[model samples]
Target: MTTTPPPPQVVGPAGAGARTGSGDVAATLRATKKRLTSPWATFAAVVLAVLWTIPTFGLLVTSFRPAADINATGWWTVLTSPNFTLENYQTVMAVDSSQSLLPFIINSVVITIPSVVLPIFLATLAAYSFAWMQFRGRDALFVAVFALQVVPIQVTLIPLLSLYADIGVAGTFWAVWISHTMFGLPLAVFLLHNFMREIPGELIEAARVDGAGHVTVFFRLMLPLLKPALAAFGIYQFLWVWNDLLVALTFAGSSNQVAPMTVALFNLTGTRGSQWFLLSAGAFVSIIVPALVFLSLQRYFVRGLLAGSVKG
Candidate 1:
C-alpha cells in the first residue's frame, strides 16, 4: 500500500514519440498558416493589381459613355447613367485621311513586323556564330557589340537622320525599318547569344560529325529551340515599334502612308486638348493589336523551347 500510485505511470517510448510528432505537426501547421496568411504580401499584391487596372478600367467605362456624359460626369457615374453606346469607337474608326487610326495601325504593323523579324534573323545568325563557331576576335567583337547597348538611342537619332538624309532615304518605310533594326540588334545579339551558348557543345559536335552543315543545324535544331526567346524579342520589338513616335515621325514621312499608330494618335489631339473621348477610344484601339500579339506569344516565354536539344 506504500506504492506511490504505480510510479506515476511513466510515458513509454512510443507514447513519447507520438507526443513529439504531434507537437512538430502542430508547429508546422502554424508556420504554414502564418506564411499563407501574411497580410503584407496579400495586401501588396492586391494593391498593385488594383492600381494597375484602374486606368484601364476607367478608359473602358469611359469609352462606352457618350461624350456629353464623359465630359459632364466622372467614369464612376457610369452606373447612374442608363445609356451606353459604341459611338465613341464608331467615331474613332470613322476618321478621314487626316485622322484614320486604322490605316496608321496597319502602318505600325508593317514597321513592327519587319523590325521584329529582321532583328531576330540577324541576331540568331550572329548568336550561332558567336556561340558555336570559332573566328578571329570573336570575344572582343562580342564585347564591342554589347558595348553598343550602353549608348542611348537619342544620341544616335540625329546622326542616323543625317545619314538617312545623305542616303536619300530620310523619309521612307525603309528608313524606319532599318533604324529599328540597327537599334534593336545589339540587345538582340546579346540575348540570343546568351541563350544559344547554353546549348551543350556535344550536340553541335555530334551534328557536325553527322556531316550537317551550320545552316542545316541552325534551321533544324537551333531555330526550333529558339522559339521562346524569339517570341519574347518579337513581342518586345513589336511593342517598341508600335509605340514609337520619335523614329516614326523622324524617319517616316507625314506624306508617307507608313506613319505608325503613335504618330496618328498624336495628331488626334488639338493644341488645347485631345478630343478626350476620341483619344480614350483611340488609345484603347491602338493597344488592342499589341495586347493580342503579347497574349498570343506570351506562352512561348514559359515554354522550354530548348528541351531535348542536348543530352543530360
Candidate 2:
C-alpha cells in the first residue's frame, strides 16, 4: 500500500538465541544417539561380544560339572540336569605330585613377578633417558629399539635358547625371566617414553629451576604421574607371561620344578586326553590369577588408555 505500513516487528535477541541453543542441543543428542546405536554397528558389537563370551561361559560351566556329565553331553546341557561338583577343583588342587598344580602355580608366580618387575623398572630408566636426557644418537637408538618390535619371537627363539645354553642358564627360571625381560624391554620402553613425553614441559622446567636433578625429577615428579601407564603395562605383561606356553615350554620344559601352570596344564592333555574334568578345572585354576589382576587394575588400565590419547 502507498500508506506507510507499520514497521515489521523485530524478534528479540534472547528469543533467537534460545531457539538456536535448543536446535544445537537437539542436534548434539541426535549425533550421540546415532553414534551409540547405529543399526549395523550395534548389531555387530552385540554379535562380537556374544561370540567372545560364549566360549568363556561354556568353559566356566564345564569346570564345575562332574566328569561323567561333561563326557556324557556338552556344557550347555548342564542347565537341564543342574548338577554341580567341587571334586574337579579338588583334584586340580590335590597335594599329589603328579596331579597337583601347586608347584606350577608357585613357579608361575616366581616367573611372572620378576618378568613384570624388571622390565618395568628398566624400561622406566631407559624411557626417561630417551625422553629427557640429551645425548648423541639418542633418537637413532630409540628408533632402532622400537624397530625391534617387528622381530618375531619365533625367529629369535633358537638363538636365544642357544645363548641361554651357552651361559648355562637354560632350563632354569632364569631363562624365562631373562628372556621375557629382553623381549619385553623394547615395547615397554617405547610405550613409557611416549607417555613420558606427554608430561608438561613447564613442570619439568620448573623442577629443574628449583635445583632438582634428573634423578630427583624422575622419581619425585615423573614416576608419580606414570602410575596409570605402569599399571596398564603390568597387567599386559602379567597376562602374557602367565598365559605363555611356548616360552615356558622352550625354556622351563616339562620339569615340574620350574614349569609354570601353563606347562602343567598342557601336560594334562596326554596321549589319551581322557581327563576332561581335570583339564577344565585346571584351565579355570590357571585363569584365576590373571583375571584377578585385570579386575584389580582395570581402573588404572582405563585411565592409562584415555591419558595415552593426549598428544605430547
Candidate 3:
C-alpha cells in the first residue's frame, strides 16, 4: 500500500482476560516455588516426614524380625543384628488358625468398597440437585445436612445398630455398609455441593443450550470436572472405613465372615497376647493398600482441597 496501514487497534477485553489468567498462573507458580524453597518450610516438612516415618519404619523392621528376637529386643536393634525372617508374615497370612487375618482382610475390602462408592454416588446426585436445580428449600436442606456433621457418630450408633437388628441385618456386612453410607452422606453432600457451585455457570448454560438434559450434563460435563472432589472424598471415606474399629465391632464383630482386619488385629492384643511379630506384620499388611491409594490419588486430593479453598 502507498501508506502504511494504520496500526491495528488491539481488543481490550480478550487480551485483558488472557493477561489476568496468565498472571494468576504465574502468581500460583511463584507461591509454590517460594514455599518449596523456603528454609523454614523445608525444615518443617522434613521434620514432620521423619516423625511420621520412624514409627512406620519401626513397624516394618519389627515385622521382619524373628518372633524370639522381636520379643527380646527393640526394633532398633535390627541395625546391629540384621536378623530378619518372613515367618511373621507367613503366620499372619495363614488360613489354618482361627486367628489368621486373611479372611478379615477380605471382609475389610468388601465393606470399604461399598461404603466408599455408595456414599459418593448418592452424595454427588444430592449435591447436584442442591447446587444447580431450582428447588424450594434447597438451601435449608443443605444446611440441615451440614448441621448433621456436628452430631457424633457415637450418638447414632446405638439406635442405628438397634434398627439394623430389628431389620435382621445386624451382624452382617449390610449393616456396616448402610451405617457407613448414612454417616458419610451429610458431609459428602455438603462438600460436593460446595464444589459443584464452583463450576462455571456459563458451561452449564451452554450444555443446556445444546439440549443436554440434567442427566446428560451430569455424566458428560459435571462428572469429569468433579473428579478431583470425588477423589478427595473417596480417599477420606476409604481411610475412615478401613481404620474404623468401633463401627465394625458393633455391627459385624460377631460374624467372622464379616469382621474386618481391625477386629482381627484387636484380637491379637488381648489376654495371652504373645504374637508381637504377627501384630507387626498384620499392621503393615492392613496399611499397604491405603498407603498405595493415598500415594496414587494425593495429587487429586491436594488439587481438590486448593480448588475448594479458592473461588474462581
The top-ranked prediction according to lDDT is: 3
User: Which consecutive 10 residues in model 2 have the weakest lDDT in total?
Assistant: 303-312
Runs in model 2 with CA error above 4 Å?
1-49, 299-312
Error at 190, model 1, angstroms: 0.9
lDDT, candidates in the order shown:
0.78, 0.84, 0.85
Q: Against the hidden reference, what TM-scores do the models get?
A: 0.83, 0.81, 0.80
Clashing pairs in 3: none
What does candidate 1's lDDT look like per residue over 209-300, in tens digits? 99999999999989998877777666666677787888887888655377887787777664465577788888889888778876777675
lDDT by residue for model 2 (69-120), tens: 8898999887777899998898878888466787888899999999999999
Winning model by TM-score: 1
Provide the RMSD of all predictions against the true structure, rounded to 1 decimal: 9.4, 8.4, 10.5
lDDT tens per residue, model 3, 25-104:
66666766787799998899999999999998998999999989988999998787799899888887888886578898
- Model 2, position 33, has a per-residue lDDT of 73
